[model samples]
Target: MGIQHVGEIAVWASARDGNADAFAELFDLHRDRVFRHALRLVRSQHDAEDITAAAFLELWRRRDAVRVVEDSVIAWLLVTTNNVARNVSRSRSRHQALIDRLPRGMYQGEGAFDAVDAHIDAEHRETTMRGALAQLSIADQNVITLCVVEELGAAEAAAALGIPIGTVKSRLSRAKARLARLAGDARAAVSTTGGAL
Candidate 1:
């Protein structure tokens, strides 16, 4: 629909044909989005970088299997990122358990921890949303991620997911409602606990 997407499609085709420059172009175009999505899932900058790299590696490794939805590879990349993040999270669980046991400084550096009320509120909302999204069924999470997080069109999301457009739209709607309910319940529970995490 946009010129960038047209360029992206051409670049992807070239990359699939073993063009190094085109592959780099694809990586440059998508790295930030993939990284941001990873950051949301993992909540760690370094882990997000690893997840983003792994997703792109999978893209090249599985190029023939990658699907282009709505003249773009973003849906495939993002879904792959999600899967990669999950796997990484699972594998890192033991390592993270040890890491958590290690002592860390308490907001020692300036700007390390923002004490602003607005910042805290935004952080809380983000945390609650991440928690709620994690609680959703995989199907619901897929629809929500494709349709809402990545802003894929219903038709595009349907194609990416191999479902009808109507199904994608309906599932997105229901998933959004469920997510909102979960967030509300979380808020209520936190408030009842005197805002304790």
Candidate 2:
């Protein structure tokens, strides 16, 4: 193993031994990467920060079960970030559904302001993209997040995913094609309605 990898593994080992300084060192090493992955998926700074925190907290909580693909803890941290993002998305969907069921007039006021067309369009596109992503199988989503979004190498992604490299390659290709098609269809549907639900 490379010196850097060896050092990282050592740091994790220290953290596992209840060394606060070592744990802090590990967090400092990985905080930005974990946060960036979360931001890419969630597109919100605040939510992404929460996801990052949760992932690290889970890393500490489940230190014994941590997987070290390529002799690094990054893969595990990234996967945990994905899981946390999924949970956040699910909770948001549930809240939105509940709000949709409520009387719309209840939240409207006499001075309620309408969003600009650009803002409306942006929200429409984001919703469309989210819908498209939601349609993918969890496996497809995970592969895409690692190989496509995070730009991890195919072998590394395979290791993290616990799948063969060829499987990661093929799944990534298929997932990208499917996502593009689904996003296009979603966009078309939204445009036909003039960005309104």
What tens digits encode model 2's per-residue C-alpha lDDT throughout 107-147?
Answer: 76424334443454477666666668767887888888888
Question: What is the lDDT of every predicted structure here?
Answer: 0.82, 0.82
Once model 1 is optimally superposed onto the true structure by TM-score, how far is the C-alpha of residue 74 displaced, in angstroms? 0.9
Candidate 2 off by > 4 Å: 1-6, 105-131
Please, what is the TM-score per model?
A: 0.79, 0.81
Q: Where's the lowest-lDDT run of ten residues in candidate 2?
A: 109-118
What does candidate 1's lDDT look like per residue over 92-118, in tens digits?
Answer: 788767766767753254344344433
Q: Check candidate 2 and list the clashing pairs.
A: none
Error of 2 at 197 (Å): 8.4
Candidate 2 TM-score, C-alpha based: 0.81
